[model samples]
Target: MKLWGGLSVLGLVYAALAFGIDQTFKWWMLHVFDIEARQPVALLPVFDLVLAWNKGVSYGWLSGDASQDLLIAMSLAIAAGLWIWLAKATHPMTAAAIGLIIGGALGNALDRAVYGAVADFFSFHIGSFSWYIFNLADVAIVAGVGLLVYESFTEGRAR
Candidate 1:
């Protein structure tokens, strides 16, 4: 397939959408909603909105003051590599998946740059079990990765 054409444009649109939505959510939650003041608000029986600052990667791993700049740079670098990959993507799903990943990565990186940490708000729990607090960017990244994995498995077979 040709490189950097219609599919790539579609991917850029998806990326812009993801990034815009992620930033908008973060802005609303932090400013308009004042999530910290009215925090831990239950949205469902098993889910809620809460404010949490993650200085590191997923699940707050590798957290510390020094790692902040490192993480931001790493995220941008990965997003840039994915953008190149998106330019060559032949399938719509692949383009979208890469776009989502790129957008999410950049979104989280921007959070780190502006807030000194990633603003995670969504929380889920059941009984004694609890999941890590995360943001929309995390959701998009996970969904994109899931789509990519699914595409890889199904690629060998017919669509």
Candidate 2:
């Protein structure tokens, strides 16, 4: 019982930290840096900071002129589902992964609610090849998914 409670607390903390960091960075980008009024800022040979507003799912899928509301609703629903999973997670890694995913989803959902889109600022490119623009929340979500995949494979092998 105590262990579960500790896990729950840990998950909540992870979620809050991830969400807060992502939001803070976004606020700094928009307000402090005033990225909206400037061109892309190159940080390295393969990385740059460029503001982009994503109104749809990953890679701008399902994004149209009239789909903002639908996207927000869908994101909220997914976050809710992940929250439930987090509550019931028995493994610490699973809880942490779920927390990361939930935090990221909620952060983006909040952006959709307030700004009508998610603010993406980090761009990675190699000469002519460019990756999708993303933010801290996207990084957390991807890392969490990678952890989950690793756990799935390792658990199966152990059993």
Among all candidates shown, the one with the greatest TM-score: 1
Candidate 2 lDDT, 1-159, residue by residue in tens = 232444677678778888999999999999999998885998999999999999888899987657888887887888777776776787999889878887888888889888988999999999899999999999888988998999999999999
Error in Å for residue 159 of model 2:
1.9
- The positional error of residue 124 in candidate 2, measured at the CA in angstroms, is 0.5
Assess the local accuracy of residue 158 in candidate 1 as a C-alpha lDDT between 0 and 100: 71
Determine which window of 10 residues in candidate 2 has minimal summed lDDT.
1-10
TM-score of 1: 0.95
Tens-digit lDDT track for model 1 on 1-159?
A: 344755888888888888999999999999999999998899999999999999989777889989999999899889878887888888999989988888899999999899899999989999989999988898889889999999999997875
Report each candidate's C-alpha RMSD, comma-separated, in the order given.
1.9, 2.6
Please give the distance, in angstroms, between residue 33's alpha carbon in candidate 2 and its true position after superposition.
Answer: 1.2
Predicted model with the maximum lDDT = 1
